[model samples]
Target: MKVGFVSLGCCKNLVDSEQIMGVLRENGHEIVGDPRQADAIVINTCGFIQPAKEESINTIFEMSQYASKLIVTGCLAQRYEETLRSEIPEIDAVIPIRDYGELAEKLQEVLKDAGNGSFSKSERALSGNPWSAYVKISDGCSNRCTYCAIPLIRGNQTSKLLSEVREEIEALAEHGVQEVTLIAQDTTKYGLDNYGRLMLADLIREVDRIEGIRWIRILYMYPDEITEEVLQAMKESSKVLPYFDIPMQHASNRLLKLMNRRGTKEDVLALVSRIREMFPEATLRTTAIVGFPTETEEEFQELLDFVKEVRWDRFGAFTYSREEDTPAWSMSPEVDEQTAQRRLDQLMQVQEQISLESNQKKIGQVVEVLVEEREALTGRYRGRSRADAPDEADGQVIFTSPREIEPGTFVNVRIDEARPYDVAGVLAE
Candidate 1:
């Protein structure tokens, strides 16, 4: 049977989709990229926020039109399995995140000839860039932020064993993956649940020992959990990229408390200062939530000020989404949608200026970029430097290569122009 897969949401969900594909392939099922060509289509849904939920639901409907047997799995399925099954008669199977271990059997039940192979937890059918992959170090979130639905959807944090994580990366490295971005709901909290202590640094050291892997990046380092040891491990490791993706969420001390975040405004500032002090060339990326419940004009201004002060190399902001069951859902003085969107726009404008200024500083600098693609119309190569992650929020280096450069090859490019979110340059002679 042919199986089509549609992975939605974050890179964490992408890992799950990859695992599902791996399971299907092991069971002798052919994986098809197109829904029209498949006997059944598996849709990995995301329910992190209202907009993401709507997008997931809409995707399910769109895939249903192809008349293929539809299977829904992931956060949305985990959170609203009953609602989806009751409402959508088209769905054949709805597997939540908890049942991912039994994915083979679930598919067998749905498609009689789907085979009886057991789920391979470690196997992944890499979907995106062949040279880059996202390795989920852990799952779920223990922090239980007031505005976050991750805990309700995916439960608490569960880190993979250090050996297991190493094995996965070794396999990826053997398969020609040069860069692996370690990701989780909170990567800093890795190993606390099972190992009794934070083991991200140890994990980094272990991965650094692996051959064939060139760049190792870690994302979602919670501000409070970023220890000196972790930074030192990154500094000492040859493979680990000096990129920090610390999600601040908000800058106001009061809002941080309300959101159940562990750190205060001062703590975050100090962390940024400490990181810059240690590695002046390190790439600092962060995210902020613009409008939360009871967020005042002063609070938003504080966040804006923080962005200006820190000048993140890459930054992203989101408007608050009031989801039910979360603590912030019923909080009084809710920020109206209009006000929230306005604040989000205002925050982004400030970030745009900061990003432009930051990028401008890189002008004339020769940076090593991992070439990814070529623009169809312009015929110029596009790629990212160590400072940029493989995401929409990060900037890209667009350059004219004298010779055609293959994707995944690293090359030095001299940046000549800077934009708000990207840079243009020429391949270095």
Candidate 2:
């Protein structure tokens, strides 16, 4: 059987998709890039926000048209299994995230007619950039933010064993992976449930010792949990990049309390200040939500002011989504759709200016870029620096090279031009 897989949502979900792909390969099924060429299709979906849910549904319908067997899994399937089974009779199977332990057996039942084959010992069949991959150190969220449905969907945080994480990275390193980004719902809180204490710093140090892994980055760190130990470990590590991806949903103290976030506005300010003082060359990235329940104009202004004060190197914003069963869903005086959209626009506009100014300052600086691809027509190479992640949120570096360069090669480029979200440069002489 040739199986086509569609992975949606964040990097965390992508890791699951890759693991599932590994299962399929181990079971003797061929993986196809196109849905039309598949005997079955698997959609690993996102149900985090309204927009994401819509995309997941749309993709299900789209993929359904291509394959005879349509299997739906991931957050959407986990959250609304019954609804999907009842409403979408076209779906052949609906497997939730919790049931992944039996994924091999379940998939075997679905694809019984397909022949078996041998596969790599690694549990993940990596997709996208072969040289760079995301390694999930943990799954789910313990932080019960009022507005977030993650706790409801994923249950409590379960940190992967330290040895397990190290083994995965070592396998990736052996396979020629140069950059590995450590990801979780809250990376700073890793090992709390399993080891009874935060062990992100230890994990980083362990990864630093791994051979062939040139760059290590950590993402989705809750601001309040970032400790001195973690910071120092990153500072001392030869491989770990100085990239912080802290998602401070809002800046208003009142809003923060309502959202059930741990840090206050002043706390975040001090955290950002301390980080800058510690690593002047560090890249700070953040995300924010606008139009939460009872969000007043003054509160929105406070968030704007916070963004200006922080001047995040890379920023992303989303309007509030009212998901059922969450505390915020029933909160009084919800922000209207128009108001939410307007606030989102205003927030992004401010961020655009900040981003442009931030990128502009990088002009004339020489930076190491992990080459990703070269434009076919223009023949210009495009890649990312330590400042950028593999996600679309970050900027890319485009440069001209006199010589042909392979995709996974890292080279230095001197910045020549800057845009709001991207920088262009020439290969350093």
Q: Of the candidates shown, which would achieve the greatest lDDT relative to the real structure?
A: 2
Supply the TM-score for candidate 2: 0.98
Task: Give candidate 2 regions above 4 Å deviation.
Answer: 113-122
Global CA lDDT computed for model 1: 0.90
TM-score of each: 0.98, 0.98
Q: Write the per-residue lDDT of candidate 1 for residues 1-429, one digit (tens) a residue.
A: 888889999988998889888888888888888888888899999999999999999999999987468999999999999999999999999999888777788888887765555554637889999999999999888988999999999999988999989999999999999999999999999999999999998998999999999899999999999999999999899999989999999989999999999988898889888989988899999999977999999999999998898888888888898898999999979888899999999989998988888889989999999999998999999999998898787989999988998999999999999999999999997
Q: In candidate 2, residue 144 scores what lDDT?
A: 87
Give the clash count for each candidate.
Answer: 0, 1
Choose the strongest candidate by TM-score: 1
Give the TM-score comparing model 1 with the true structure, all chains together.
0.98
- Candidate 1 stretches with Cα past 4 Å from truth are 120-122
